[model samples]
Every structure is written in structure tokens, then in C-alpha cells.
Target: EALDGGPLARLHDGDLVRVDAVAGTLDVLTPGVLERPNVRPDLVANGYGTGRELFAIFRDHVGAAEAGATPFF
Candidate 1:
């Protein structure tokens, strides 16, 4: 699972999860299996490309992709 550190902060690596797309919800089968987020520094984008700076505003302000990718604040 992609650990974004948003709502599923308590989920761990081996924890079982059930996803119900029809109901639009996720159920954690095993509780108390929280794991610390493993954020890799090498995976972080540094915005060092031609014309890449132009979209920096959109990258920083855009809302969730599942929410239509709209700008916010």
C-alpha cells in the first residue's frame, strides 16, 4: 500500500485490509498494527526541469486526485 500518511496512519506493513469499492470504504482487518512512515529522500521531487517550475503552483495547491484534481487555497 502507498503510505501517504493521511487517514491510514495506523496501518502497518503486514496488516490485512479489505477494500469495498461499491461502498467506497476500507476496513482494517487487524487493528494496532501501526507502522512508521518510510519516506525516502531520493523519491522526493526537487523541481529541477525546464518548464517544470511553471506547474509548481498547481502541484502545491491542487486538491486530491480522487477529488477531481482541483486547486485549493
Candidate 2:
């Protein structure tokens, strides 16, 4: 009874995925999911702009000062 005509009916809740296309919508794979959530640091260090940007964004926005300073990256 999925309304969107997707393959959700065929999928389990925790399935891994890479969406190749969606009808009448932008075609892009899922960027990051549970099985893979981050670019490796070595890969980032090897001149990937997107990875570097992601790293910088994470470093700048993660964590609060009062919670004992847990590192997010």
C-alpha cells in the first residue's frame, strides 16, 4: 500500500540501498547510509574536495562545551 510507487513494499526496514533513479525526480544515489557514513581520512587527505568540505563542516559544528568535550570526528 505504498503510495509513491516505490520499491518500499519489497524492502525491509534496515536494508542497505543505492537508488539508481526515481521517476520524474532527480537521480542520485543515497549519499551516506548506515553501512557507509564517512569518507576515510586517507581518502580525504588525497585531495577530495567534497570530503575535505565535509570534514571542515563537521569540525566546525560538532559538540558543545559543557558536555565534557567529546570529539565527534
Candidate 3:
């Protein structure tokens, strides 16, 4: 999963979430979800390494994944 600059980073365990791609919306159903403490991820290691070089500019393009992490057909 990705925890970039988005709501997914703030969400915690047991929190309710709703996503409607058609309507283009993402909502947190759990009460006081935002009131909880912010969860900051360790982004230092992501700057380089971790097999990221595989996606270098010379590599073939990789298709995008859908909501369920399914690759485009």
C-alpha cells in the first residue's frame, strides 16, 4: 500500500473508509477519525534503493493497477 500525501496515511486500524470512483470521493466513516494523532511514515529509506531502480527510464512501461490492485487488462 502507499502512504503518500493522502488520507491513507492518516487512517488507522479499525477506521471506516468509503471510496466511490464514479463519484470521485473518499470519505472516512469512523467518527473522530481525523482527531486521532497523525501517523507519519519513514520516508527517508524511500529516497533511493529498495529495488526502485527496476523502474528506471530505460525499462518497459508498467500498466496501472485498479482499485483491487489488479493490473490493467
Candidate 4:
């Protein structure tokens, strides 16, 4: 939900996506895809409240789902 609610917030239906596992790359193929503004998440709300801060390390370092979404090597 991070990317969907963050950087890729502008993403919508019919947007083309390109993936190259061999080269380890993912791209949004839709034109102007990079031009849109990203949705900014509420930092305080995300990092605080309901004990969410307990997982701060994971929230800070985790990668994309396509990249296995792991924070460690």
C-alpha cells in the first residue's frame, strides 16, 4: 500500500507497466507517468499512533513488492 498510496498514487487503470526481471528493472510505460505529482503520506500518522512506530525500521527501508519487499540483503 505504500507505493500505491505514495509515489504511484497517480497510477490509474489502463496505465502500462513494464517489468524486466532479467535486468532487474520495473517501469511504468504510460506516457507522462513520471510527470504526475505523488501523493504525500502523513508522516506523523504513519510513524506514530497505534504502536506503528514499532516497525519504523521496516517502514523506512523496505523496498517494492516486485523486489521481494525485503529490507535486508
Best by TM-score: 3
lDDT per model vs. reference: 0.65, 0.42, 0.61, 0.76
Q: How close is candidate 1 to the true structure, as a TM-score?
A: 0.42
Ten-residue segment with the worst summed lDDT in candidate 1? 34-43
- Which sections of candidate 2 miss by over 4 Å? 1-6, 20-73
How are the candidates ranked when ordered by TM-score, highest leading? 3, 4, 1, 2
The lDDT-based order of candidates, best leading, equals: 4, 1, 3, 2
> lDDT winner among the candidates?
4
Off by over 4 Å in 4: 1-8, 11-37
CA RMSD, predictions in order? 5.5, 13.8, 7.2, 5.9
Model 1, C-alpha of 14: deviation from truth (Å): 1.4
Q: Please, what is the TM-score per model?
A: 0.42, 0.19, 0.47, 0.46
Query: Which lDDT tens digits does candidate 2 get at residues 14-65?
Result: 6556544555343224433323423323334544565676566555455543
> Model 2 TM-score?
0.19
lDDT of 3 at 35: 69
Q: Write the per-residue lDDT of candidate 3 for residues 1-73, one digit (tens) a residue.
A: 3343355667878888998999988889988766666667876555458876664432223333334443433
* Per-residue alpha-carbon lDDT of candidate 4 for residues 2-54, written as tens digits (9 for 90 to 100): 55555467677899988899998878889987778777555675678898889
Instruction: Show where candidate 1 strays beyond 4 Å.
Output: 1-5, 33-59, 64-73
Tens-digit lDDT track for model 1 on 1-73?
2335454655657889999999988888785544445553343566658888887888667776578768763
